[model samples]
Target: MNNEQIMNLIQEISEVQAAGNYVSFTCNNFGIEVFVMRGEIKKSKEWDRTFFFRKMFSEKRTEEMYQECLEYLNKMKETV
Candidate 1:
């Protein structure tokens, strides 16, 4: 999907996240349900600041799907 469409999806996910719940949606191209949950990453010794977390899930997880999810996350970060 294009950047605008991707951004829209990210926004929708963020809205659901803000409400303290997980959101699931099917990817039109992959026909797989993508689940998203929001939380915070614990601070580590190497990184003092705790980073925001966007946990993603799929029934048949693969590298390509992971990359796609990362793409969405990067886009979301950019918008933020």
Candidate 2:
């Protein structure tokens, strides 16, 4: 997906996370699961760093997404 699409997905995840809920979605060969645990947002590691990930998602984009998630997760944590 392009950066805009990825940002949209990130926004959706953030919304669900802020609401204290969980969401999972798959896009082409990529997928993500987001939820809260111990009052912090968390992402599932079910498909992280796997062969499929390397084949489907560019390392740069994947890291970008991860960093964005971390930023949002930390932002949420601070508000609690």
Backbone Cα, N, C clashes tallied per candidate: 0, 0
Considering every candidate listed, which one attains the maximal TM-score? 2
lDDT by residue for model 1 over 1-80, one digit each (tens)? 44564566567567645655444555554333455444432333232111221224333444455456656554544443
Whole-structure CA lDDT of model 1: 0.47
Cα RMSD for candidates in order: 12.2, 11.0
Q: For residues 24-56, what per-residue lDDT tens digits would candidate 2 score against the true structure?
A: 444454455443343433554332221112235
On a 0 to 1 TM-score scale, where does candidate 1 land against the true structure? Answer: 0.32
Per-model TM-score on C-alpha atoms: 0.32, 0.38
Residue 65 in model 2: lDDT: 63
Q: Model 2 segments beyond 4 Å from truth?
A: 1-31, 35-55
- Taken over the whole model, the C-alpha lDDT of each candidate is 0.47, 0.51
In candidate 2, position 48 carries an lDDT of 23
> Which of the numbered candidates is closest to the native, going by highest lDDT?
2
